[model samples]
Target: MSTAPVFAGPDAAVPRHVAIIMDGNGRWAKRRLLPRAAGHRAGVEAVRRVTRAARALGIEALTLYAFSSENWRRPAEEIGDLMGLLRLFIRSDLAEFQRENVRLRILGDYRRFPTDVVTLIDDALARTAANTGPSLAIALNYGAQAELTRAARRLAERLPPEQIDEAAIEGELETRELPPLDLLIRTSGEHRLSNFLLWQAAYAELLFVDTLWPDFGADELSAAVADFGQRQRRFGGL
Candidate 1:
């Protein structure tokens, strides 16, 4: 029996849109008898690795669930650490993005983030907008229910009772411009959406791995893609 997953397989097709549920940093730290902040720092490294790998593989779009609105419930210190890491990543990754021609975008409620952090995000996005490479979207303070509700409210405020249709609702969605998800992977083995890109990932092939975010690397991502290549996407019917 093959114990390790194959990184490249002829059966696997490259995904155009891939979303990741980055989970299990805390658990990973606890297991090592290290501080939770350590795990978070390690997870950030994993993010860099996966992004580079995806770009190298010529993936069109990569979306990461960085921080959800519910994450505010965590300790203030941890939040601070996360925000610090985010800031560092943005400042340092800009050159890498320019080199790779990658366009960086933040997907979520900007109002909920700190003013300074929001400013940094905006600047980073603007600077990379013209890049002709892969689009890397980071979800911060995002909630699927909140996104859907906001979309619906916008529609209600703009139109009366005559133009309600699937296309209308979809047009109102935040992810209207992005392609439908081809694969959704969750690290740390928790098989739940946790309120991610609910509308977009409707029929995406899901892969749940036992590895934690900190442990996930280029090899792990490649293996997931290899698995994706083996599956025949039927959408609804075979």
Candidate 2:
């Protein structure tokens, strides 16, 4: 994995939107000689911490790559454990999130999920729909390639040949309702996209950190934002 240099610029700005690829849960547990499920359970605490941090930072939106489509390749027991965690998280936190005016959005093909999990997701969305605070989007069972392909198919089905364009496809994306992705941070020192938010992250600043997801806290978050502030984004120009 390649590391990007952090330059201290005179202007430091907090991105409006932040996304994180929370990695290293399994490794963390393996290192401790515990079951991988322990790592996943610990990762849940990090999620709560990061979500609170983002809101405190005045971020407009935060998207977490909670579960990728490829995650299904894991052992059945592990997947069941993750599903249980998801259930517990939504069931326990939905009320607190609503109380804090935090909106909950799921950003993946949830139809493939079990009926009960899908119901919880739907219920969470409905309950928090009126929230006006920072929006938290969890990418569950999401793969950017699949997302793009689905978007393309949807466009082809509805629009004539001449009517299709980048704008049309962008509008059809799951992230269309949220602000543009500004910064994408991957924990556990990984430096790849891993099929998460491919289209939305076209121009996002990438930050790969060595900290495991379970250990990620406000300090790490602050550092990432600080690093983000130091860089210059020229887009396509000098």
Candidate 3:
């Protein structure tokens, strides 16, 4: 539960993997006396900027927590706007992903989304599947607890309790395919994960940047990476 001490750097030595818990959109909008949807829309730009930054720097992977299962509790209009933005981003970014040589992969449950969004994401994933560059993984309709529960359920169905262990369960989780997460960023000064990538971020160096998601551009991200580069990742031992 302890966070790594804040470390500073010049951004040349960057971490290979960066995962983000995009927060503070609603608060950002509220402070402006605008609807929460406005902040959400602006956050999309931050996503693009951060992705571009990662790709330009030749980072191996960038995972974004775009939406969570708990988001369903929000009012209907906000939810609709969020879904609309998701579809639009997929459709529009399909070309950008290919042009930038970024591999796009949508993480989390696809079944819960509207049919149009589902198709758009499917097409986008297939279209950019050939790219072998920076991997942009977006988590939508995701909940870390839900992910763990699903993994546990799947494992439980295949093996008796006696046969399953930590390694086996980790393998069954969705984030298992990626290398161990190196850096985890959460915007808006929020200090907790809020059910983002529970299992994958076991050893990740956590960075809680104060910038709101919509305004978090490359410099802010670079600053966080600089901070991440200075910590001693002891994992579970000395």
Candidate 4:
């Protein structure tokens, strides 16, 4: 919504949890007459920039919608490029994340990933599991509806009917371990969630920006945070 560049001090209103729908990589590449892989690569750089900015901004958790379950429908080569980027990012950033105390976690059905990727993901998690810094959760093969269904199944298999309440379901959700979501942003001017964190965004303030994912940087992130600071969150109350 608001694209104004606003900055707030540490004492100002800041969201503890933030999520982003990194969109328009293909479009970004197409605009420049480049291969889609180039845009995906640039998007990875954007991810790095935003992650560091979020840490500096005192955000406790940052969830990035990297690969949705529906993303599998895209061309096989594009998927491979994305997976390659994921591997490179983890291998390249693991030590840096440990040094910065940035804990890493996966927010999706990682079981579907290849054995090598799953191993790397596990390694990254193991390395950063005890860090005491802002957490970065990458959503791979994730969809909120699928997550809800999986949680429901888990609850049904493990709990009695009487115990299946909101609290129980919330506990089963993957995002239960992270801070409650406060701000959600979508890039590329898209206004819809596209199967992102549906349940977790119950009271989150939404902001849509026209910048493509490859071009979004820390400044854009700060602008969104500033916009969030300017708004009042009633959470169903006046």
User: After superposition, which runs of candidate 4 have C-alpha atoms over 4 Å from their true positions?
Assistant: 1-12
**lDDT per model vs. reference:** 0.86, 0.89, 0.83, 0.90
Per-residue alpha-carbon lDDT of candidate 1 for residues 23-85, written as tens digits (9 for 90 to 100): 989999999999999999999999999999998787888999999989999999999999899
Cα lDDT of candidate 3 equals 0.83
Q: Supply the TM-score for candidate 2.
A: 0.94
Write down the TM-score of every candidate: 0.92, 0.94, 0.91, 0.93
Q: Which is the winner by TM-score between candidate 1 and candidate 3?
A: 1
* lDDT per residue as tens, model 4, 1-238: 1122233334457888899999999999999999999999999999999999999889999999999999999999999999899999999989999999999989888879888999999999998999998889999999999999999999999999998998788888888888878899999998999999898887788999999999998899999999888787766766
- Tens-digit per-residue lDDT, 1-238, candidate 2: 1123233354766887899999999999999999999999999999999998988888889999999999999999999999999999999899889888999988898878889999999999999999888899999999999999999999999899899987898888998888878899999988999999898887789999999999998889989998888788765556
Candidate 3 error regions (>4 Å) = 1-13
Task: Report residue 36 deviation for candidate 1 (angstroms).
Answer: 0.6
Best by lDDT: 4
Model 2: residues with Cα > 4 Å off, grouped in runs: 1-9
Clashes of each: 3, 0, 0, 0
RMSD to native for every prediction? 5.7, 4.3, 3.9, 4.7
Candidate 3 all-Cα RMSD: 3.9
Per-residue error for 54 in candidate 2, Å, reads 0.6
